[model samples]
Target: MSLALKNEQYANELWRYKNTAGPQRQYFRMGLAAVLWRFLALHEGCVAAHCAVPGFGVVTTVPSTSGRDDHPLRTMVADMVGATRDRHRDLLTPAPNATSLGRTASPSRYTSSALWGENVLLIDDTWTTGHHAQSATAALKASGAGSVAVVVLGRHLNTTYGDTATHVEQARLRRFSWDACALRPWSHG
Candidate 1:
């Protein structure tokens, strides 16, 4: 199930906050955590409750292609959901010398050999083509994970069409001011 539309200003802000590196990254990370927390709370029956049921062994994240061991989205989701760092394992690694899989690509960019027999709940920052998630899930199952479920912060959508592009532009302009500092609540600790 999708939570946010990629074209919306809030979602664009989230994507930018996640992908861009800067001083504001920390703030956006926290804001994203808060937003994700609220979303899970609202959809507890589907997300949190499902997790609470026994048999789900651990909560992990889709490994980032950036080569960073620590992913903000993964860490934040783990924190919000009460998953310890130990429980949130990085089971998958990027393929040998593979570069960032921009927009879309085959799922073979990642490889995993870790063994897990319990259920897994995978969290990701964004869903573009879902190749990342699909690849991770396949690896998990192949490695012996009983089952795998995915939750992503945003679903990216193409806005090339005239009407959709115009709507997205309007939403972006109306929902956010140019000066991000003014939007302190989203960044507040």
Candidate 2:
């Protein structure tokens, strides 16, 4: 399936309702997305991926498609978390796992120094496909992010950590070691 479609499907399968407004739901959504971001960063072995701050809302850009503008997966992530857009640097370089993955984090007009604000969260409501996350991450990386991650509210059961809630929980646990929470999913058990 297409990344966009997949993201939608994943979002639908993972979430029963859209509770972006509730404090509990919002926290959980951001937390879940943050967890996924850390997981991908550690799994991908990219230092740039480690430094994300999991934003909470949507970031809309390019190719305005009617309802697509409102896709939960695309609309729910916060904004860029830490680094300001000015921090980003437009350099065409391959992400650490570029070889395994056909896509690359090449430079683009989205370049800006403020893009690399402090630890930031590229939040999303759900993960039906991951296209939204993928694109957002690439943009963040290109904008000069030391690390970038796409946080989402929900994930598929097959991909969920399952009974290892404790293990998974550890990955996201943080104690204000820095200005932003260091949710390193890779270290989780």
**Candidate No. with top lDDT:** 1
- Compute each candidate's TM-score over C-alphas: 0.66, 0.34
- Candidate 2's C-alpha lDDT? 0.39
Residue-wise C-alpha lDDT for candidate 1, range 15-108, written one tens digit per residue: 7676777777877777777766655444433543455545445767887787777777666866644433446666777776446555545456
Candidate 2 lDDT tens digits, 1-189: 101122345454345334345675566445444544444333323324354334322232221122233443333222322221233222222334433433333333123344444443444444544554565566666565545544444543332435645543453474422223234533332
Candidate 1 minimal-lDDT segment of 10 residues: 180-189
TM-score of 2: 0.34
Candidate 2 residues lying further than 4 Å off, grouped into runs, are 1-114, 157-189
The TM-score, computed over Cα atoms with residue i paired to residue i, of candidate 1 is 0.66
Instruction: Give residue 119's error in model 1 in angstroms.
Output: 0.6
Best by TM-score: 1
Question: What are the lDDT scores of the predictions, listed in order?
Answer: 0.64, 0.39
Worst 10 residues of 2 by lDDT: 56-65
